[model samples]
Target: MIIRVRDQFDAYSTNTNKVLEAGIDLKTRLFSEGGDSPYANIIAVNSKRVNDPAIVALVKALKTDKTKKFIKEKYKGAVIPAK
Candidate 1:
């Protein structure tokens, strides 16, 4: 029961099916077990203006200790927020 990346956020948190791991997560496991990674996993944003207070606030929030703890606790490492 593999789900696509586009549907994971909804399907993963709510759907009855148990999500074993994401493809990237599997690759991370393999990489740790001495196999090459299939590819890199990452997140990015392309905001037109980086100076907006909302945007600044978001970036700031994302880097904070509270936010990092919240993400780790809430997502349980399924969503790895970059440090």
Candidate 2:
């Protein structure tokens, strides 16, 4: 799966557009068949904050919950996707 975060911009509209662009770009790069597993699911997240530590923590928490739900619904045999 993928996670994307936005950066602050001069305007909220422009920032949102940039966030979408960045998310698409990241998804393409990370999921490209020549790059990584093409079957892997992609997840996009937007955040204006620019702190790596905070982002990491947030991602960890989100992954924990999301994984549980995903396993329960989608893949009952696996707790999480193999990275």
Candidate 3:
């Protein structure tokens, strides 16, 4: 069945044993198509809050290599870090 990359992870979790047996393929356009996927995890900051220390820190933390590594390890190919 057609599903987004992130949603496929959810399907994988629920159908870990059945996926291979059922012959279901979960492929993501992000990797296969070599083009940008419309889906993304965005962090929108308000104009006024852009300079807030907490917001700044949060954004910094999210963009760190450590965070990227965590996302890569935890989500496998399901989630991609923003560039």
- TM-scores vs. true structure, each candidate: 0.45, 0.24, 0.54
- Residues 21-83 of candidate 3 have per-residue lDDT tens digits of 444454522232112766555789889999999999999999999999997786565456776
Best by lDDT: 3
Error of 1 at 16 (Å): 15
Write model 2 residue lDDT over 1-83, tens digit each, in one string.
Answer: 12232233332222223434454433332222322445545445566554567777866765686766775576333223434
Q: Of the candidates numbered 1 and 3, which has the greater lDDT value? A: 3
Worst 10 residues of 1 by lDDT: 26-35
Range of the 10 consecutive residues with the lowest summed lDDT in candidate 3: 26-35
Superposed model 2: Cα runs more than 4 Å off: 1-36, 50-55, 62-74, 78-82
lDDT for each residue of candidate 1 in 8-80, tens digit (9 for 90 to 100): 5532331211333333433223213112434334335566666777778887887899987887787565455
The lDDT of each candidate is 0.50, 0.44, 0.59
Please list all clashing residue pairs in model 2, or write none if there are none: none
Q: Which one is best on TM-score?
A: 3
RMSD to truth, every model: 8.9, 13.0, 8.4
